[model samples]
Every structure is written in C-alpha cells, then in structure tokens.
Target: MNIPMFTLLVGIPLVSSPVVYLFGRLTTRAQVLTRQGWIVRLLALLAVVATWFPFINLWLEFQARGRRMFFNIESIWLQLDGISFLLAAMVLTLGTLAILFSGRYMAGDFGEEKYYAMLLAMIGLMIGLGCANDLFNLWVWFEAMAVSSYLLVAFYREQPGSLEAGMKYVVQSAVGSALALLGIALVLAQTGTLDMDQIRLMVGTMDLNKAGLLAAGALFFIGFGVKVAMVPLHTWLPDAHSQAPSGISAMLSGVVIEAGLVAMLRALSTLTGFALSWGWLLLAFGALNMLYGNLLALQQSQVKRMLAFSSLSHIGYILMGLGIALVSGQPAGAQGAAFHLFTHMLMKGLAFLAVGAVMYALFHEQGIHRPLVAHDLNGISTRYPWVALSLSIALLALGGLPPLAGFMSKWQIFVAGFQSGNGWLMGFVVFAAVNSVISLAYYAPLVNRMYRRVTATSVKKGSASISWTMQLPLLLMALAVVVIGLFPSLMNWLTEPAGAALMSIFR
Candidate 1:
C-alpha cells in the first residue's frame, strides 16, 4: 500500500541490471549459476519475489477499498500523475515468471550475468511504464524499454544477423518514439497538462481543433503501432524475434508489446472525448495486422519466425477489442482485451519456453534449422513427456482451442464484437476467427513432428535434470492456461473491474 512497495518492485531490477553487468566483467564463470552468476540470479529472483508481496498486499487493499486503483505513488518524473497499482501488480507477476523461466533457458550461456541484468532492467522498465499515470513519464519508460529490448535482441553481438536485427529494431523504435513525443507535445500544447487524468478532464472542455487532434492522434497511433507491430510497421518484429535469445523472445512477444498496447489504451482513454476517428483507425490497423500476420506466418519455415508472425496476428485481436470498446463506449470490449492480454502472455510465454527446450536439445546436435522429422521425436513423449505435453498444451491454446486460456479470452473478445452490432467490426472479428484456424495449420506440424511422425534413427533425449527454477514457471503457466480456459470467470473478475476503472477516466 506504500510507495516503497511499488518502488522496490521497480527499483530492485533497475539497480540489478548494472550490477550484473559489473559481475560479468569481474567473474570467469561459464554458466549463469556459477561464480558470481548464482548470487546475481538469486538477487534478481528475490527482487521479483519482493515485488510480488506488494502485489498481494495491493490485491488485499483493492478488496477492502472496492477500488480498482490503489497505492497512488506520485512524484516529479515527467508529469504529476502517478502509477496504477493494479497494472504494476500485473507487470511484476509476468516479469517474475519470465525471469524464472529464463533460468534453464539461459544455462551455460557465456554472458549469463549480462543477460540476467538486462532482463531485470526490462522488468523494472515495464513496471514503470505500467505504473506511470503521466504520459510524459510513460513515453520515457516506453523508450527505455525500446533501448533495453534492442540490446537484448542483439545481446549476441558477435552474430551479424542479431546485430542487424537489433539495428532495425532501434531505427523503427526511434521513429515511433519521435512520433509519441510529438503527440505528447501537441497534447501538452492543447491541454496545458501532462497528467493523464488531467488530460482526460481537459479533453472535453478544449476547443475541437480537428486538424491538430487528428494529427496528434495519428502521431500517438504510429508510436504505439510500431511497438505493437501493427501491419505495415511490423517489419522489425520477425527479425528481432528470430534472432534474440529465447528468454528475450518470450518477454518480447509476451509482455513488452503488451506494455505498448497498455500505454496506447491509456492515451486513447484520455482522448476519448475528442473524437471517434482514433477508434476507427485502431480497428483498421487491427484488421490489417490480423490478415497480414497470419498470411506471413503461413509462409514461414523457421519456428521462431512463425511464432513472431503469430504474435502479430494475435495482437490484432486485442486491438480489435480495444477498438470495439472505444467505438461502442462500452466496457465489455476493453475487458475482453484485458483478459486476452493476460491469456496471450501466459500462452505465448509457455510456447516460447517449449520452443527453447526443443532448440536447446537441438543445439546439442545440429542447430535450430534442421528439419524435425518424425523419427527425430521418437520416444520424446516417453522421455521428456512433461516438456512434450506442456508444449502440446501451449500450442493448442495458442490455436484458440477450447478449454484453454486462449479460447476463453478470445471468446470474450468475439462476444463483445458481436454485441456491438457494428457490421464492419464484426466482419473483422470473423476474419480473426479464420486466422485462428489458419494458425492451427502451422502449429499442427510441430505436434505431428513430435508425436505422429516416425523416425528411423532415434534422437538423443535432453538432460533429465531441468532446474526447478525454470520448470516451476513452465508447469505453473501450463496449468494456468488450462485452469483459466476451464474457468474464464477468474479473469472476468479481474479484467472487468480494470476495464471499469479505465472507463471512469472518461467519466
């Protein structure tokens, strides 16, 4: 309930990143858990755990107060508005799980110390982005995340391709940041306030300068669009996702993009009183992303690249939900978007972790490129059954199959779309459903390669000793996927109230 609790969640990781970099310089360890790596990992993990305590406390506080926002921490960061207590909780939860899953994924890497540090730093930035109620502060954190992410993507600096991907990401992100800053300037020029709550209040009273508002809206959309990888601006995503470390890939696809979306939603909520054109623009972009992403993914041969494109497609669905909420001025679509955001995070995180396991095993033999024929997976279901099973569940959920978290969230989005009675938007939702089936065409091959295909020569099994630190998160996420799928009400309870709070920003 105190600012220290929220600050600790963010500050610990912000401080740990540089510390890990320093450790890397002083230590001669090969594996992350060896030499100074263990201590760094412990501290990073502890920082995550410490952050979780406040989230728990906040949850309790929310229950008692019957208020969605709590722990309002304010200071002179960029503007007067402080962070959202609930969004902070969500960021901490996802960031902790991401780091935990990285344990095994990053094992025996050369730059483990640096890897953990960047990761922790990413966690800190995400918390700041989520918590910041000031648009200027949000933009700062947004750019910070962009820089950290570019570094992480190119962490394998020795690899030319990785460096290239990182450069591409940086260029695109810089353009986006510039646009966002311009939008912020425009908003400030018009409203004389940078605080999101204050902006929302002034938006209605301000003169309706159509040209300026539209330009400002376009600027904000382009900025967030680049991060969200909306169609026509998503060129950097596949390259970055394909080249980045598996753990970084997970975070990128799972949470980082969502942070951008959250910021966009916050900005949109603030500007709702101005016009409905912004909502229309978001809907158009969402439809384009869904169509283009699926079409591109259908052609990808690389596993990671396919996942990257799939991520783009799924983000379309979230945008669709947001668009619907804005167009109808109803909370259902926003709630659906929020729920889907969480479900997508869990499902994609699990999927990437599973892919990491496969890649790790393959690295022992050839590399990620070798075709996984039927015989290659012989007895994999028997030996590493847990990994195999988890991967299967993740893939299925990602395909939007029922009784999984993915399906539950998507169903909510679809219901909201249909309820809006907007014919064009409903058509977009239908197209998204079709894309879901298209996704299955790509995902099914992995399952077929693992279970149904028969190999002549058996491949070697992965080491039986998976670290508890890593396995626990995967197992929990896998279980969560199924649990939320079966019981959608749990997310409904969380997201519905969050959506209500967002809507209140307008009222």
Candidate 2:
C-alpha cells in the first residue's frame, strides 16, 4: 500500500515498536535462535533504515520544487508542513543513529525487547510531535513522547536512582503538559480553532482587551520551558540524564529538547503582537542557561551529569537564536537555529556514545559505585583510540571550534544577531561565546585525562573489539559534523524552506 512520506515516517516506527517486542519474545520462547541474536539485531536495524526513506523522499521533493514556504501531504491521519518536515527529518536522523548505537550498547543487557520497543515508540512520538498541525494533536504527541521517555529513563528499573529520576521527569512533565492544555483551551475559546495556521490568522483580527493572548502565551512558554529544560524548570534533567542509559540520554539531550523548542516556536508564531515580550523572555532564559549550565557543569565530578548541564547551556544558545528570529524578523536567525539544532544533535550524540563506551569497559571492574573521574578514563586513548578520537572531535565541535559543524552554526547565529542590529542580542551572543570558552575548561580536562594522563591501577582493560553497531553511529555523526562544517550549503538549503514556512505564518 502507498503512503505519504509523512505517514511513513510516523507509522513505520510506531508499528515496528510492537513488532520488535513480539519478535524478540518469539525468538526467546522458541529457544531455537538464541545463538542467532543477530537476526533480532538486523530487524531493529531495518526499522531504523525504513524511517530514513521518507527523509530521502523529502529531500528529493525539495529539490524538484523550489524552496517554497510550505509543501504538505495531508490525510485523515497525518499532516505535514514545511516546518514539521524539517524537524521530522532531524528526529528521524537522530532516532536512527540512537537505535543503531543501542544495538551494541544493549547487547549484553537483559530486556532488549522492551528497550528497542520503547526506542521506536519514542521515535514515533517525536515524528508525531514534529508533524502535528493542530494544538490538540501536538499535545497528544507531546504526552506520548513524554510517557515513552519516562519509561526509557527508568528502564533500569532495578536501579533506585533511575526510578527516582524517571518519577521526577514524569511529574514535572505532567505539570507542564497541564499548563499547555490550559493554554490550548484558552486559544481555542478565543479563536475556535486548533490549527496553528488558523490561530495565527485569527490572532490578528481579535481584540487584545483582556490580555488573554499574553496569558496563553505565558502558559505555553512555561509548559515548553520544562520540556526544553530551561532554567528553574530544569530540575529533572541532570538526574534523568545521569541515570538513564547512555543512548537514551543522547536522544534526550540531542533531539527531544529541540522538539520542545520547535513546539514553543510554533506557539509563539501564533501571537506576533507579543513578540517583543516573548523575545525578551527567551533572551533572558537563554542567557541564564548559558551562564548557569556551564558554571554548574564545572562543579560536577560525574562525567554524564557534567555533559547534561552543558546540554542545558547549549539550549540557551539555540533559544537566543530564536529570540533574534522573532525580534529581528530575519530568516537568517531561524536558519541559524535550525543549523544549530542539527549540529548539536551530532555533537551531543557522539559525546554520550563515548561515555557509554567508557561505562561498558568500566562497569564490571568498578561497578556503579566507582565515581567516573577524569583520571578513571586515563589510558582510554591508548586502548580505544578510535573511540577516543571520535570523542575528542565531538568535544571540539561542542566547543565551537573552527571547521566543525558547531562553529558554523555559532558563527551564523552571531552574524545574524549583528545583521539585525540588536546590540543587546549581539552582546548576549558574545556572552555565549565567553561561556563556550568556559565550557572548554571542563571539557579539555577530560581529553587530557584520556590522552595525556598516565593510567592508574584502578583503570580497567578496555574492550578489544568495538562493535560495528556502536561505532557506526559515532563515526557517522563525527563525519557529519565535519562535512556540514566544510559545506554549510547543504543545511542552508534544507532550512530555507522551513524559514519561509514560519515567515508565511506571520504574513
């Protein structure tokens, strides 16, 4: 049967999630294929590959048609907008990489069936959230993603910290979802429509006597703020990221928060009159995140928690770009945000995967009791040289060094701020650059530990053979960071259509 590209992106992962569980169970029950675990691995691999087809089709379609404001494939079950298309493509790409990485990461772990199932389910919900055009539909998918993530965060149910982190995540997300629902209700009461495009048009014709728009905007911002883990609302992030599986942590830090930002941007697009106030709010939060996240990261002894806090700070940079887009009304700001989102995905994913490799080597020797100090990872460069190299590249990219994807994105955002003539925004961007330098203080120590420090007696023997499943994702993401940095036109072409789409919403 034929399906639209949008439907396939959403459906394939949603459908395969259950199938993975069933097939995994079947294999276990029969006891005939225990030795051939590769079969189940291949099946999971195929599911991820299937999801990529739609993005390929999307690229082809964009090439055939000029970068228009919108190109949609609408049906009873699925709807696609240009903005949704770009975000969905990002979700799919990251989802595929995460799943591929997990195949190796989870190889020896029990409950592989459930792990793969939840992974696919989260991917499906991410696609749903990205492509949803109506407020209610967006909320539904948002909750779906949240539920899956909560379960995934606590996937190691035996670990008390994991369970506690998951509980905290769910409770905070529930509160955020309730606020979003209230905001949606207020908007629907005023405009009698849930469609984003319709709401944007309706806002222009409505009276602003009661400040209902502002109230709704505040609610929406608070709701999505929690999702993106903006300051004050971000209590659950460090705990969850530190406790969860590394692949899931990568997914959470890399793509899930980006999806939340996309939702907030969509909501903000509906209330153009409040753009200045919202822009200031975004700017304030972004600045706070950059300052707070990095400084807190410096204090953390645990490697994963440090990275989690760093992720929070980088979210601030992206939000700054969004704020510029709103205040300056420039496509360049939006384009920069998109480029940053893409590069952050690769950089963060590789970083988490590197941590996973370290954990895999040390889990038996040290158990979870041994703290992961910079010194603990000493001699990893000698043992797993490729992994060490990949991790170094990822860290340098995260630090926004030249000839890397992160640098390209950061440069564009700073240029866009300058072009917009927003002195305050430009100053904030400069502050972010300073924060990036501060971040290097923490990140550089880890590299030094890996490459330069002498191995201690506590260090364990590293794995002799790195699995293809794990290595493939890191390699691909590392290469992507370099490729996109060298040739930025590829991302610019993809993001132009999306920028046009948001611009049309205002028009």
Q: What is the C-alpha lDDT of each candidate?
A: 0.75, 0.81
For candidate 2, report its TM-score: 0.94
| CA lDDT for candidate 1 | 0.75
Residue pairs of candidate 1 with colliding backbone atoms: 83-131, 375-454, 375-455
Best by TM-score: 2
Task: Write the residue-wise lDDT of candidate 2 on 1-507 in tens digits.
Answer: 867675676788899999988878776656766655555667777997888887678667766865532434453344455677777777777777887787767774667788888888888888778766778878888889889899999988988889899999999999998998898889888888988777877787767434888888999999988999999999999999888888899999998988888787777678767777877888899999989999999999888888899899889888888778777888787778777888898899889888777776666323443335667678788777878888888888888888988889988888988999878888988898898889898888888888898874455453445677778888888888889889988787667777667655544
Tens digits of per-residue lDDT, candidate 1, 1-507, equal 535554565677788778767766566454443365556566667777776775666566666767545344454442111225435655666678877777666654667777887888888888778766778878888888888898899987878889899999999999988998898889888888888777876777666565776677778888887898889889999999888887788889988888888777676667755435766777888888888888898888777788899899889988888778777778888788878888888888888777666566655234343323324545465555677788888889999999889999889989988998989878878988898898898777777766765532434533444556666777888999999999899776568766776556644
Total clashes in model 2, counting residue pairs 3 or more apart in sequence or in different chains? 0
At residue 74, what lDDT does model 2 achieve?
A: 58
Candidate 2 residue 212 Cα shift, in angstroms, is 1.1
Q: What is the TM-score of each candidate against the true structure?
A: 0.91, 0.94
Model 1, residue 438: what's the lDDT? 84
Our model 2 lands, by Cα RMSD against the true structure, at 2.2
Candidate 1, residue 492: how far the Cα is off, in Å: 2.9
RMSD of each: 3.3, 2.2
